[model samples]
Target: MRLRWPVALLVTLLVVVLGTLMGSRTPAEAAKKITIKDSMGRTVRVPCPPQRIVEVNGDVAELICALGDAGKIVGASSYTLQDKFFTSRLKKAQDVGKSFTPSVEKILALKPDVVFGYGKFLKPEIIAQLERAGVPVVLLDCYKIKTMAEDIRTLGVILNRQKEAAAYIAYFEKYRKLFADRVKKIPVNRRPRVYLEQYTDYTLSGPGSGGAELLDGVGARNIGAGLRVPYPKISPEWLLAQNPDVIIKACGSSITSGYGEKPDAMAKKRAEMMRRPGWSRIAAVRQGKVYMLSSEIFTGPRAIVGMAYMAKWLYPQLFKDVNPAAIHKEMLKKFHGLELKGAYVYP
Candidate 1:
């Protein structure tokens, strides 16, 4: 109590030091939390990189795995895993229900701190359910393959894995150039009169679809160009009138209009396309120009796989040197340590 001024100051410093030594937090605890925004404009803040995450988009799950981290995800929409798209990655995943009904109970049980989802398909009600419960939901859209590669960077920024994301985007860019070079060399006469088959039937992609865009990307001419939404129904007779040189079947979601699954079964469900019985004379069938593609590959980040397949299909001579199947196999090895399957046409 009777200490001199200098001594008092020294004592105060000692007390402050002692308190800091006893009460200071570890470096890990002091790190700043990250806040991310979903495409729908909701903000998600996490105290730390979470141990459990719920994903609504199948492609987002694939991209996360490609970024080398699927172990962080605990929940997914049921539809994604039902198909070949999730073949290798579904071992640790659990179904949360369809895109329309992601099980609140199931997701809640996982106790996910972060929910990563995509699409306008996820209703506002489901999103509200998550936000109301204080779960941070971040939406990432990768509907187009071109934009899909860009979205990896967005996810990277959120997950704090920027380098991995950049690496993936860079990889996709290389393929884009490979496609462009081949496209640039094709002459007008050699460009195939391409038909973009959206469904098993005569549903054709017109001027404005991912399939149509990809067809254009590889310098092929779409016979259905200038139509409204692309994949409008076309009559078999009308299709024969055009006499397309090549036909690329690009499947999309919603395969159940009572459609049976098989190349020949296509005639039953898509009766309008039956090139026989009441109607059977399309040049595509007679010439054997038809090819089947995966439904999932038609949209989402998986579209990259679709695009690679498209490039190879459009110009076998040009891309004969490049093996699309081999590229996918290599992607699986480096990205997910899983094998690629169901990404192409089945015999």
Candidate 2:
């Protein structure tokens, strides 16, 4: 038998033995993992410094891009691709379809090491499907002010970009403290009554909404806070009765107001809102306090930028030295590596 041994058979046996020895150190053994709790409170084990990422949430994508890990993204939601910043940074990332209903097959095809999604939009079944296929899904809602810092910290740990994350947190805390200190000085009676409308007409953002949280953070009273639903459609009569001191309409992508975009569309929306029947009697309308805010800033890590603008709008005298536009410009240049050239707030 030894004399009759074929060269190909010997080679095959040698290769199999070598593979067996090396296979003892499996891929899981070779890759290190870290355990962290996602925004949804699920304990997930994700590879440290994930090389390939599929980010379904645009907000998280913004944070990832800001952290200077844009090159790690292999796939992104369609909404993320539409954003100027994300589009510029993630030009090569594959589109994984809609944020709410991302294509599982498309995401799997990208072979991402981890997936990041908004807690609200990512269904449980979708998460299970991804996990079953050996993909880890990390839900981080970067839009909420309350959890944004912690979310960023967790994200830093995952991306191995702790330094960048800390820097952003410091920037965030600076304005957060500034807003808190100045807003606390105003008397409750003097606080501006703000009516925050969503992209849809008559749809008001209530307690659970980011818009409501922003208004509350800036020491303004959200007229719709008492509503049971997060987004409630109210009658025009009810809005008229509120007589808000300030009106802020959140314009979505449909209205177009962001980097390199014009303000004409936002201006048109604001004018239409002001022209609504019986709107002239509203304090906000009469005093020209109606403002249109681009959703780009108001609902993500950049919400602080939107807060700066709101602070200036709600109390011009107090925040006179605080230039929201300058802060916004700095944020874009420092974090996203973009020059500010678009209108975010409408006159």
Candidate 3:
């Protein structure tokens, strides 16, 4: 079987090249991936159930943990990765940056297999940079209640947490349905015309906000819905005209950096600053329906909290009084093993 050396060498090289080409062409031979589109409608192919993933938002990071895959998250938002609830579960990972802006060099250095981020916070330029560095980024948006359930399902596909995600979605849907059915029992005359003051100044979290959506779901109407802006600038005159039955100041006017301020103190400060002659006559101010939104659950993973809050605010007798504080405690304990105390404030 011995042949000329030159001919034998040529034949061996051809065989090796043909075998490599065949392996590359075969799906079974190459690394298999499940193709899925991110929240932004960008096709991102995740390799093998995501051994290493980076999250740029607290909700996304928390979702990864709820999915029981903390080990896979290599990088997370500085705020979330440090949260006692999330950081205790994921000890090794640390601050990549804020959600909207992350250190490109640090992320590239990690060489992560997949990156999970929020649509509202993570910038498109950052996503582009990650792609340029040859990384896969999956953006998810769960900002509003309407699309929140769908967003959870999308996360399930990417993280392979479909079962847990489905269960959570089902739980929220069921809770909402039950709450709505109860609302239907209320006579039209008894339904409260509520004003949900999500914020002050330019950033009034409006009908599109989670709080307003919940109010609408439970039969209470939001006065801000007719304002005609995604987040309209509020004028004192409009408040006078609407004459809301109940005013829920879910949160105070906070610049992003100055969040978690007391609603009463903030209101007093605003009142002194703007001496609108008729402002004091508003029904909400007279009745003190204004309240603070004391938890992060209103938008993200705290659908249970939102339900509890709405139930208590709208129909206290029917709901046996939903305690947002207690619900926060249970969720933190079950999901992250942390105890919460007095997070929501009525004062």
**Best candidate, lDDT-wise?**
2
Let me know the TM-score candidate 2 reaches against the reference structure: 0.91
Among these predictions, the greatest TM-score belongs to: 2
lDDT for model 3, on a 0 to 1 scale?
A: 0.67
Model 3 lDDT-worst window of ten: 252-261
Poorest 10 consecutive residues by lDDT, candidate 1:
256-265
TM-score of 1: 0.74
Q: Cα lDDT of all candidates, in order?
A: 0.67, 0.90, 0.67
Candidate 1's residue-wise lDDT over 1-347, tens digit each? 77577978999999999778757653223435686655555566763555677888777887877776677777888766665545566577778887666887788777776777764667778878987887767777766555666567778876678888888787777876678776887787878888777755678877655677677667888888867765588886777788777666654454421112344433233434434442335555566666666665555554556667777776777778787667767766776666654424532
Number of residue pairs clashing in candidate 1, backbone atoms closer than 3 angstroms, sequence gap of 3 or more or interchain: 7
Give lDDT tens digits, candidate 2, residues 1-347. 34788989999999999888878653433578999999889999998888889999988988999999999898999988987766678989999998989999999998888999989779789989999999999999999888889999999999889999999999987897788888987788899899988989999989888888888788998898788988899999999999999999998878988878899999999999999999999999999999999988886899988999999999889889998889988988998878888889999
TM-score of model 3 relative to the true fold? 0.77
Query: Rank order by TM-score, top first?
Result: 2, 3, 1
For model 2, the stretches where C-alpha displacement exceeds 4 angstroms are 1-29
Candidate 3 lDDT over 156-213, as tens digits, reads 8766778988977886676667778788878777888876666564245465566677
